[model samples]
Target: MRSEALQNWLNQFTSRSEILKNIRDLEKNNEELFEELLREGLTYEEVKSRYTDFSYYKGLKIPEGARALRAVEVYVGIMDFSDPSVMRLPGWHDGNTPSANLIDTSALFGALSKRIERPFLANKTIYSRSNCLIRYTGEALYQLDWDVLHALICFCRGQFNKRFEVRQIDILKMIGLSKAGYNYDLLKDSIVRLRKTDIYIESSSKSPAMSFSIGEVKSLPKGKRRRIDTFSLILEATILDNNVLALTLDARLKFLFGNNEYGLIDWEKRNKLKNNDIAKKIQCLISGQKTNMQRHRMEKLYQLMGLTSSFKEFTRLLKHACEVLLAAGVIKAYAIPAAPRGAGQDRIITIWTTEIPTPEELQAVGRVAAYACGE
Candidate 1:
């Protein structure tokens, strides 16, 4: 059972084109929720306007830009922060130039910092200081693509349910995209890629890598469109049929689920994170620390993030992420011990904060720029 406040947040609206469409219906039922929306940065008038006159959404089809009821009545997103650990990838890439190799058998074994665009000479025959690797069955990947996988794994661990049955829109929301803002075709493609994506984990130093995919996905179209919007009147009860399809995860990864491994994430910071993958990874990797601080050896951090950029380039990227996070107030201080090369001692980075900055502090510093695609 959900608290009335949280339930109102989940069940209080209908959507069109994956954008919110039926808030008015919910407002009448939950004034408290409506007020919270205002606190979330919506203006009183904005809140009122959206919910007060949403008479549209009678016979809308999701693909046709009509408002459809989300039908996501029971939000189990609480299982979100359960397990935060991610498998290590052979962290070598062709600088920041994402590779389209499709299937990468060559491991970027401890290949340090990606500063220039060049082929990643990986250590294929050597033993990598990692427990696993990744192989995409098809399509090139984006940094956000990795984040998508991380979110799914967290969802599975949090729910105590190895199998998942989820709506596409719900998944997008969790990954920090507004339903209307993202490209619908791309969203669908992301799902296919994630399902086809495989993760390899080592049971022990001598054991071989074990591979697994995220989950199975299917779309369930509802019967003939009800044509609700043009008719201009809708009962609040109608939006419950919103979830057109659901996705389920593989059970093999369930063994990876549990407390201590998962970190309690700062969702607000995550939602505000721009086009920085290292920054996003850093956010999740250092969640819910007892002293509000975290540290990692440089190599371990690289392996954790699966970085493939050259050492110089990778350091620059790391520097960039820390700058962005610092500006965003995600961290108060950050440092990487400048150890000389061949010193034979470890170089480590640390970030700490007395308090997680509020939304106001973040806004004041200005948000990090979102990456522009193919300019």
Candidate 2:
């Protein structure tokens, strides 16, 4: 089939409830693919080279850094920080040019503390201290849109993932730790623990994240006396910053790439949840009594965006909006190394929006999401 035609067919099939059920099943059985490869003596380097491309190679298109991805689609705007007397505040700028000294996280925390009427408890941790860069305290106020927040979280997730993995190894190596013994085991155990907490979900079907095992030489060669010299295991749950695209790729990769043949739940029969609704629900769940008022704003978001209909359709619309944004150069897309491993109807997506979208722009993106979902 022509690529365009095939895409259309996939899009249609993904919207159906029956197809979603099949996709979940397919994702479950797909884990065996990695297990099979390990059984056949394939090392982590071999599989990663063929799949994720973590190593540097001439003429290879490694995925862009997560922060760079965020910078590309980020929207900048000026803030009007006028005093009660209508006098302009210091550090105010005239246009969209963000100040060179951006307000660091601490200042922002101060601002938030002031706004929320809370005591400013200080911590020495980097996350607690915040970045020292200063731009404008006022302008930072406007960039807190859900899309923008989502992108920031995505960036944080990426940074956290890379730092935890690479930095730990670097630290171990710096301390003159033995490559063959103690350090290696510690790193391996840490990685397993991190994956369990961050990626794998603990439920009956065995989340695909935990389904694949590290290709340890000892584990790979069961009865052989090869002394278990080396091994590598590619973690299956790598999600980039492009939320919608990442989600789509994740769903497919989980279903098709591995040995699993189980499919996703049927949306029609099982009644798939709506994207906007889910977002609101999640927001509510995450919100404590302190953040309860924030829920009203999100509700306003739904109303202004006219996303009061089906949640399933809202996701489709969001995908279409992302394509439009990509075409408009407001966002970029990343191609995963492997096809998603799942069967059925749902389009799994992980989309990030700008931190500060004007009410108009917010409505526009919402409209785009609505349109794509065929709402």
Candidate 3:
């Protein structure tokens, strides 16, 4: 039975019939606490405040430094759970597929690279560029791992703090891999690596330093029986039964992805780049930058890609990658200028015009044109 105070609080949403109905249904399952609180002579607002406090602190061990951060208040009253579309994560929801893949700039820059020869390192700094620093304490991730991570991010974009379900096959398809038995095994390995990996990201320009695993995954048993052959993926914080892979993306990811600190990778273009790992890496770096024309030192590029090849071999590969990018329309032109006598480093200059430019980019172009015309 609903308490009078609970009833009064719910009455305020009379105009939103669907939300009101959902709220009523949810309250039916959660009425005991409200009833007990009402019996204790607590007012409606007091009860609500207490409930909010309880929900915020429930199963969470917030550190002293993190306590100063503001909490994201999610109002359950406005949520329309009856519509499955409403519950879908952003970018991949409702069959409205996004043309580009969204990724945090820090990760896009070079957090994960093609260094897979060494075993997992403990408390090792994987990548550091400019003001951003990334430390990892698990299996060393590579380009494929980056793709897997990006797919997970797409799955949990809007609901970063919430647990959700995803199928293993869906993940495979998202990363442009075939759904084969070997692929399933590979996916499981990647998932385990991601789960065990503890990442510490610090970007002075974005947010305070934070540490968390990329995600958590648990493989469910087959049906009522404990068989383990076929399984789907489920994203949940808690353990559950069934032949599925349960995943929970770390909530701390919001710090990196929020405040427009993320960039969009052209999904089609990336897929087209395919097995050319160097070109793909270059695409990621170029996509994350604001300007279409950019120059990067050859040594810096080599380090950023984590290539183990000799400088001469890397330079040869880079030239080939630039040619590939030009052929794919990812870049209009690229030039590797000859190093001057006594110069320590060579530079690669690239110019491009994206198929779809942001408003800010458009304005910048407009300003450039006006300046060129002496307006």
lDDT of 3 by residue, 77-108 (tens): 33332221222222344222222212322333
| Among all candidates shown, the one with the greatest lDDT | 3
Residues 228-327 of candidate 2 have per-residue lDDT tens digits of: 2212112222333421111111121121112221112111211112222233222222221222111122222222233334444544444444454434
In candidate 1, what are the lDDT values of residues 119-180, reduced to their tens digit? Answer: 32221222233443332223334445554554554444333223455565765766677777
Local distance difference test, per candidate? 0.41, 0.25, 0.50
Question: Least lDDT summed over 10 consecutive residues: which range in candidate 3?
Answer: 366-375
Query: Sorted by TM-score, highest first, which candidate order results?
Result: 3, 1, 2
Which residue segments of model 1 deviate by more than 4 Å? 1-143, 150-166, 180-182, 204-243, 288-293, 339-346, 353-375
Give the TM-scores of the predictions, in the order they appear. Answer: 0.45, 0.17, 0.57
lDDT of 2 at 33: 32
Quantify how close model 3 is to the true structure by its C-alpha RMSD in Å: 13.5
- Candidate 3 segments exceeding 4 Å error: 1-118, 206-243, 341-344, 355-375
